[model samples]
Target: MMDAALQALKQYFGYDRFRTGQDQIISRILNGQDTVGIMPTGGGKSLCYQIPALLFPGVTLVISPLISLMKDQVDALKDVGIQATFINSSLTFSETNERLSAAAQGIYKLVYIAPERLEVSGFVRILEHMHVSLVAIDEAHCISQWGHDFRPSYRAIPAMIDRFARRPAVVALTATATPRVTTDIRKLFGIEAEGVVATGFARDNLNFQVVRGQSADVFLLDYLRKNRDQPGIVYAATRKEVDRLYARLTQQGLAVGRYHAGLSEKERAASQEQFLYDDLTVLVATNAFGMGINKSNVRFVIHYNMPRNIEAYYQEAGRAGRDGEKSDCILLFAPQDIRLQKFFIDQSDMDETLKQAEYHKLEQMIGYCHTETCLQAYILRYFGERNPSGCGHCGNCLDTREKTDVTVNAQKVLSCVKRLRERYGKIMVAKVLAGASEQKLRSLHLDRLPTYGIMKEQTQKQIGEFIDFLTAEQYLVQQGGAYPVLALAERSLPVLKGEARVLKKGHIRAERLAVDDALFEVLKQVRKTLAQKEFVPPYIIFSDQSLREMSARLPATDHDFLMIKGVGQQKLEKYGHAFMQAIAGYQAEQKNAVN
Candidate 1:
């Protein structure tokens, strides 16, 4: 059975190996176990059910939330010569019935449906008649109210499964699920702990970065100008920001598009198509843009503001480098971003408890932005996965450092808090230390204290940075209340007594790589020509990774081309000759030039 599954993987998807947790999940499902797969974004979770669908005796019913994802997956599957179809609100009533009738007759091997369809009486009646062999739920975290994106529609899944004449093995999959959300999913599906397979969240190919104290507009313009031709997504927090960024980028004459809920359905679809088809090099969007998008070549995902929580940020940022190539995930953060997120929490319809949970998650996200530790390690730890620190590729680890011993500065700050009775927030503390002439300071007599103005050499921004760092490192803790106050922790005793040292790194920027423009251009031409001939997305034929590999390897024959990662038996048979011919021609041209 395992061998058959492997055969299906190679034959259909063109992959020679299973990613970390895919094989076990596939094996467990084939062995007749109902499972929950908690893999990271880009971890190949779809293959868990996809491969089994090929082996199952009847059809696989896939419940997905997004219409775009359904169309994208169905197209990709059909491109690989797999029989698949989708039934969604986009179809006319007659069209839906036609597809449902075909599915009942086993004309399609896999059927994709929106979760809302499961609640429809007519759709449920049709599903009961279909010979369903498997029920695979994508974005399974939507079922958990504790999750960042919860949908009440997902609650209808288990009941829908019960209506099936022959109960199929259930596999629930999600890219983002906290421990609490994971338990909820398991309990909802009645799956035991051993039946759950969570392959940990870590994307080594992504370079995570957080830059503060810079104008986001200026920084974004500079960065985009440098990598003008590469594919990227700039995520803003609101539709207004999306529109603003879109207008600015468009004014600069870049191939960019904008997506938000505000756009009409036709406009949103057109914008998405433009990006997916490589007509747009950049997409400026709110969180609404990326849920089920499978565009594989996005080289960067920049957050114009911090998201409300780590789960949302990680999922959004993980969209980059889905093809397992080097990509950038940058967050341009400002303190006001937190205020904006807090405003969202205040306006949300969630209950008080859920709102409190969101606030706690927000604080963790703020600590991540300010922490001096390795960025990757911080994210992995947040997801309950422990790994060794100092992943050498993150912004902090790759930064050229001049570590200043801030032990004395930390002691001064902690002592000032004590002298002031720990009644103030960070700004107040900085004001007292920077010796500001504010009336509040004078009225409170804080200006008369000996500790005041001791660190006047430091700028207000510098003081705030140090304070945020101290709070993150636990030398200073923030008390919880309507107006939280900064209080010294037990660890501060060591720093105050000169027993512990604190270090701060002055980070120098790293150099960017110069792309192989000539070869990259040639490959794009070939991909465009091929995509035009086939009328499919270019990445579907050969991902950006495949093209990059081809350019680097200069494969001159069919055999050599097959060795590339995404090239499989099916793809090799269909498109190998053309790519190999292009590579051979390019190599010959280079040789002639050298001669």
Candidate 2:
């Protein structure tokens, strides 16, 4: 069975070996044991069930959270020569029934359905008649209320599975699930605590970066100009910022698109399609974009503003380099971004407990922006990975800027926070430190403190940023929800007692992804033309990774073409001639030019 799985993997998906933990998950599912797979994005979670789906006697039901996800996965599955179909809100009633009837006839090896469909007795009744050998739950974290993106619809999944006369072996998979969310999912699904297969949450192919204290717009424009041909997503916190960035990039004549909830469905879908088809090189969107997006050529993901939490940031940023190529995850952060996130938390309808959780997450995100350690390690640590090693390519690890001893400056900030009774936030402390004669400060007599005006040489903005750095470094901690007060942490005692030193690095700048070869460009054009003819995204034809492989190997024969990593029998039969011909033509042209 394992050998068959391996053969199916290469014959259909074009991969010879399973990614780490993928084989384990697939073996468990094949053995009729329920499993939980916690792999990072582009970690081949889909293939765990997909390969099993091909080998199983009955159809594999994939319960996804989004309609777009369903469409994307189903389309990719079909391209891989697998019989797959999706039943979702996008389909008409008759169309849904037609697909369901097809599934009943065993026409599809995999059926992708939204979770909400399970709630409908009519749908459940239709599914009951089909032979379901496996049930794969994508984005399984949605079932946990503790997760960043929770959907109540996911809670209906276990019950839906129980309704079947013969319960299918269940597998839950997600790219971003913290230990808490993972535990919650295990409990709900009755998965054994030791049964979880986590491949760790580290994305070694992604270079993590956090850019602070710079003009975001200026830096973005500069960075875009450098990597103009690269496909990337710039995520803003709000629709307004998305619109602003979109307009600015458009005015600069960049091929960019925007996606947000504010746009009409048609507009959003059109923009998303344009992005997926590679008509646009950059997409400026809010968090609403890129969930379950299967496009594999994205080279970078930039955060125009700080995200509310690390999980949201990681998931959004993970969208880059899905093809397993090196990519950048850049965060452009500002102090106001924190306040803006806080404002959102304050205005949310969540109970105090949830709101507090959000605040705590936000604090961690701020730490991410300010921490001088390896950025990738920080994220892994956040997700509960123990003592994960740092990727030496992130902004902090690569930062060669001069370090200045800021211990005295940190002491002054801590002293100010302590003198204020640990009740004031950054702005108030900055004001008092800068000797601002605001009515609030004068009314509270905060100006009379010994630490007041001690940092008069620095601007209020500088003091505020220094305070943020102190908080991130653990010398000061932000307490309270919404409007948090600055309090000295245990680490502050040593700094105040002149036993600890604080060193701050200079500003870090963005770097460009590696440039592609000329042959790779030619192959991309071939892919674009083929995709246009087939009415599919270019990646649906061949990923950037595959194209690069082709360009490097310069395959000339059918046998050689099939040896390319992503080339399966179906893809070879369907697209072999065109790509092989293109490669031969390029070789001939190079020969002629040399002659």
Please report the candidate that would top lDDT against the real structure.
2
How would you encode candidate 2's per-residue C-alpha lDDT over 426-445 as one tens digit per residue? 89999999988788888888
Q: Given candidate 2, what's the lDDT at residue 426?
A: 87
lDDT of 1 by residue, 205-287 (tens): 89999876445677788888888888889999999999999999999999999999999989998989888888889999999
Q: For model 2, what is the alpha-carbon lDDT of residue 501?
A: 91
Q: Where is the poorest 10-residue window by lDDT in model 1?
A: 505-514
Root-mean-square deviation of candidate 2: 4.2
Q: Each candidate: what lDDT?
A: 0.87, 0.89
lDDT of 2 at 209: 84
